[model samples]
Target: MIVTIAGAGHMARGIGNRTLAGGHTLRLYDRTRAKADELAASLGQAASGADVAAVDEGAVAGSDVVVLALPFPAGREVAAAWAGALEGKVVVDISNPVDFSTFDSLVVEPGTSAAEQIAAAAPGARVVKAFNTTFAGPLVTGEVAGRPLDVFVAGDDEAAKRTVSELVSSAGLRPLDVGPLRRARELEGFQFLHMASQERLGLNWSSGIAILP
Candidate 1:
């Protein structure tokens, strides 16, 4: 599958590397063309990068999926910008809308979530929420304590969620279906608490969330 990721940050690069390793083509875009170019260069020919607006709609025009690996606000903005271009495409939202200043809460309004917001912004785009729980480092390396990482996915569309689940598994991670898009509130809220705990407890970015058997 061809996956176009809008953002060339650590999260974007990590996901792009995994997508490439999974035998999928990747097109990475960022506000800064140089950052995208640098990332594409590092990943070789299987991956290419460009400015978000410069990313030909053709690149994503026939892609199996497109990932919004951006921060919350940017993700929303990009989703809005690409809404018309992304019709009939599965859009994955891997963002947690946390209030960084508070370090313990989501920035989203009380009743909605980042995923839902993105979904609303691109109504024709099938938005699936996943990868918000896993940090960038673990996603790139594909292991934590020698075990494959676990990725939880949620979305209103079952097929879309399954597609993302397959992508997660192909990237060498365990995929757990965590219910519908409404559940994203929990996921983002959990991330807020986790980030706070990491800072308050000094646990470092190497930490991750996992379900116990």
Candidate 2:
């Protein structure tokens, strides 16, 4: 499986490392070509950098899955630009849509989510909402102590969710299916609280949301 990631930021690098380690080919694209090149260097032979427009659409064309690891606004733009190219492919939305200014709530309005908005923009693609609740540092590390990090996944399509779940598992994380697309509202809302808690409690990025039996 060839996995293409749109951003070379923390999240994209984390996912790319996991995907490449899992034996899949990885293509990464970023506005900063240097960042992509640096990441590809870190990832070795399985990873390479390319132009955003051409690489994004080309990855969708050649790969089974495409991960939009960018911020919400950027993800939307990419989805719109690659709408036709993303048809029949599983698009994973890992954005939280949080208002960084206040860190109080989601940038998306009530009853809607970033993932749903991306889905709306790319009607041809199957969108799955996931990875928003976890911090990038933990995602890259894959665990805190000895316990595997839990990744919550939600999507309109069960098959798409399954595909994402498999990727999560492949990355050495536990993927929990929280329900359908609408549940993304809950996930995003939960992320808002989680972010607030991190600041309020003065916890580092190492802090994570864990579900115990």
Candidate 3:
């Protein structure tokens, strides 16, 4: 499968690492070309023989899945800007809309999540909320403390959710389908608390949330 990830931040690199490990082709895009190129090179070095490259944002057209590894506002903006292009495509929103300055609450309005907003913006796209609860550090390895990371997936489209779940499994992680897109409200809220507790728990943002059977 071909995966296109936007944004060249830590989350982008982490997800790109897993995508390559899963043997899927990875195409990275960032507003700043240098950042994308740098991340692509870094991921390539870590995953030898991996198929990865830095490409223009337009390249998302050919991707099987397009990951918005960006922040809340940017994710929504990109979704809207590329709405037409994203039609019939599976779009993943992995942003946690926490208020960084306060770190006490989410930035989005009550009852709605960043993923929902992005979904509203890209009406035609199969928007799925995933990877929001997993921090970048643990995502790179897809595990923590010898346990696989649990990626909670929520979307209205069954086929799109299945596609994302398969990708999560292929990357050696667990995918938990937590109902429809509205479930994103809880996922975002859950991750907000997880992010808030990081410092108190002294997790160093390296913790992974796993569901034990």
Candidate 4:
């Protein structure tokens, strides 16, 4: 599979490693070309690193899955700008739109969510909400606490959800299909607490949420 990640920061690096490790070719795009080149270089030969390269944003047109590893508002803009290109493709929205100044509430309207807002902007794309609950630390290894972290997937399209689920499993993590896309409301809210917990309890970004027996 050709996976395109549209960011050059931590989340992109971690997710890029997982994708290359999964044996999928990767195309990375970032406003700063050096960051993407640096990330691809860091993956090294062990991950078939040669298969990954820094590409133009237009390269997303050829990918099977396009990950919007960006903030909520930026993701909305990309979704709108690339709506036609994203048609029938799995577009992963991994943003948590919390009001960082207060962290007490979401920046989205009461009834909708970040993922929903992005979906609205990209009507032609199959939008799926995932990875927001998983912090950047554990994603580097795709595990935490000696256990696989659970990735809650929410999307209206069943086939699209399954595609993301398979990608999650291939990366050695657990994918929990939470429900339709609107369930992203709860996923985002729940992860807001998880993010707050990291700072509140001094977990040092080492914690992850899971569903256990």
Model 4 sits at a Cα RMSD from the real structure of 1.3
- What is the Cα-based lDDT of residue 115 in candidate 1? 95
lDDT of 3 by residue, 1-213 (tens): 999999999999889988988899999999999999999999999988999999998898999999999999999999999999999999999998899999989999989989889999999999999999989999878998999899999999999999999999999999999999999999999888988898899889998776789
Regions of candidate 4 where Cα sits further than 4 Å from its true position: 45-50
lDDT of all predictions: 0.83, 0.82, 0.93, 0.88
Model 1: per-residue lDDT, tens digit, 15-115? 88788777676787777877777788777744444222225445677678899999999899988988998888899999989888877578899778999
TM-score of each: 0.92, 0.91, 0.98, 0.96
Best by TM-score: 3
Write candidate 2's Cα lDDT for 21-103 as tens digits: 56666787776767777777777744344222224345568877888999989999999999998888899998988899988
Clashes of each: 0, 0, 0, 0
The candidate that achieves the highest lDDT relative to the unseen native structure: 3
Q: Count clashing residue pairs in model 2.
A: 0
Per-residue lDDT value at 39 in model 1 = 80
Q: Please identify model 1 stretches exceeding 4 Å from their true place.
A: 45-58
lDDT of 2 at 159: 94
Overall local distance difference test of candidate 2: 0.82
